[model samples]
Target: MIVPVILSGGSGSRLWPVSREHYPKQFLNLHKDDASLLQEAARRLDSLDNVAAPTVVCNETHRFMVAEQLHQVGVEHARIILEPCGRNTAPALALAALAACQASASARLLVMPADHVIKDEAAFARAVMQGQALVERGRLVTFGITPYTAHTGYGYIKRGEALGEDGFNVDAFVEKPDAERARAYLENGDYLWNSGIFLLDAKGYLEALAEYAPDILEACDSAYKAREEDADFVRVDDERFARCRSESIDYAVMEHTRSAAVVPVDPGWSDIGAWDALYELKAADDTTSGNALHGDVMLHATRNSLIHSESRLVAAVGVEDLVIVETDDAVLVADRRCAQGTKHIVNELKASGRRECQSHQQVYRPWGHYRTMVLTDSFQVKEIVVKPGAQLSLQMHHHRAEHWVVVEGTAEVTQGEGHGNTGDMKSFLLSEDQSTYIPLGTVHRLKNPGVIPLRLIEVQTGTYLGEDDIVRYSDDYGRG
Candidate 1:
């Protein structure tokens, strides 16, 4: 059996504004569809023979988003593994191999990153079949994309002696080459772009890892053995998982292993690492210009430019080779040639302590979302939406008082000292034009009793209206 391990733990900083630290590009519908990149990745393996439900390894912070996205795609029971901290691809794969080995002793693991895009599913499946055959013969396999150009953004893999019809022994792994060397590599038809997809048997991988990356293997072994299974997630022990030395699979094992092999894949695969790459994938006019995600854009006489606006209409006049991104709090305009340096801007924001670099004005929660509409010294206003049957934590704020005016649907409001009691909990069914007030230190909880989304405008008056002022007494979603 082949157990597909999907790694979805990247903070896509290059595509900022649209992709923030809390919410990255993998979760967004970059192709302007309901399905995200991660969802598409999970769906791609559905037709493969002997494929088990995907085992997802993601960061702990993105656990809710991962769960919600998978649930949206009708995946009810996938093995969702949570990484306490990222130790790069090697340890992540080691943990996944350990899990698959525990479930089935002879399982073959097909590891793929969740953020990639493969346009041709049939070609990808055929490549996977070749990879599976190689893995069954005890070969550590990696997919190498047939390079289309002298692109310096990605590393290249050199092919060695041919092992089969569609497989070759990996000659060497080369780092990102300079422009001249990249051009030379493209000219010589023996190199392929390192696509970072791999296939190997569970026990074979563990043995190869023990030989090449013993420290990583040992750390992962201890972490997996010490893991505690929650309701639906497998939580690796924090101390052991953190002790794993951070490294990629290329550096730790694939490069050093004698059994390494490569399979050529030319299925329109793209990592989508930068704005320029996204522009290349998008539909373009004669001017080679496109709009970024979630923007009202109008371009005239523009060529090779990407304009994105979130809050207002953005018009570009006579601009060429530019990237313009606008969010609620910040806007960025840069040359398309230097789009890779956008990470420097994120680093500067981190050094100077700016919230705009981290998240947006609207924050997503498992229940719903709350957007900060207005803020002031003595008061703050927010628009909150609660999904049907969803409830906020039973909590109280020490330094703030709140007034809620329901605009749509019905809200079940509980107030006063007897917050959780059966008889003392007075349920006030609030509808349109109805409102309620809760004084400071009063234990209150809000719930959407109706089948529709509950929308409300919240006005707060307090000495301190920060989010940390709340003391959660009880929560339904296991949040402390």
Candidate 2:
């Protein structure tokens, strides 16, 4: 059996505004309307045979989103490993390998990132099959993309002696190069872009890790041994996993392993590292004006540019080789050539302690999502939606009182005092146009007890209206 391990722990700061700390690029439907990049990655395996359910490794905070998205795509039996802190791909892959070997001793693991775009699924499958064939011989296979341009965005892989028709011994792994070096590598025709996708025998990978990076192997082993299962999530020991030094697969294992092999392929792949990649991707599909526009956008003489508007109309008069993205809360404008520099802007926002750097006006929870409609020093207003059969935690605020007005469906409201005692609670149903008030320090829970979604307007008044003001006495989702 082949186990697909999807690594999805990137912050994707370069694609901010749309991609935040809480909702990253993997969970976004950038190329497709209904399927996200992660979904596309998971669905890609549907073409291959003998593949088991995927094991997803993501940040702990993103566990709900990952599960929800996978469920949306009819993937229910996935094992989601939650990392308290990212220790990079080496440790992430180690966890997956350990889990895979535990399930089936002969299982091979196909590891891929969640946020990559591969247009040619057939070619990708062919490459993966080639790697799988090589894996049978105990080869640590890395898929190398056949480079067509002098792309400085990706590292280069030098091919050594040919293993077969489509496989080669990995001669060297080169870091991201200058434009000159990149061009040389492209012209030389002996180099391929390091695609970061790998196929390995589960037990063989663990042995390689033990030989090449024993400390990482040991740390991950201890963490995996101490793992606990919560619903669909497998959570490792936080402290032990955090002790594993952060390192990429290239640095910790592949670079040191003599069994490294490469399978060069051209699968129309993109990491979608920055806004420019999106432009390039869309521009490929439409070549009339070299402009890739999304949402409510009107462009005039905007050649070779990308303009995306999420909530409102964006008009560009005269822009060339530019990228403009407008969301509900923020807008990004940059030269397409310098789109990679957007990470520095994210760093600046972080240094300034800006909330926009972490999240948007809308926040997602296990129950549903809430969008801040208005915010101020003394009060705030939000529009919240609860999925059918979903409920919020039995929670209370230390410094704030809340007023909720039901706008759609029905709401089951529970309000109480004194140590969150349900026996002392007053529970009632509020239909459309009805309202309820929750005073400060009152234990309250909201549930959508109808067949449809429940929509409500929430007004909060307080001296401190920060999200941390809430104390969750009991939670349906295992939140602290």
RMSD (Å) per prediction = 2.1, 1.1
lDDT of 2 at 43: 93
| Per-residue accuracy of model 1 over 430-454 as CA lDDT, tens digit each | 9998999988888888999889999
How big is the RMSD of model 1? 2.1
TM-score of each: 0.95, 0.98
lDDT of 2 by residue, 1-480 (tens): 999999999999999878899888898999888899999999999888889999999999999999999999999799999999999999999999999989999989999999999999999989988998788878999999999889999999999999977599999999999999999999999999999999999999899889989999999999999999988899999999999999999999899999999999999999998898888788876688898888999888779998889999999998798989999999999999999998998999999999888988889999999999999999999999999999999888889999999999999999996644555888899999999988888889999989999999999999999999878888989887
Query: Where in model 2 is the C-alpha error above 4 Å?
Result: 417-423
The number of the candidate with the highest lDDT is 2
Q: How far is candidate 2 from the true structure (C-alpha RMSD, Å)?
A: 1.1
Model 1: what TM-score?
0.95
For model 1, name the residue pairs that clash: none
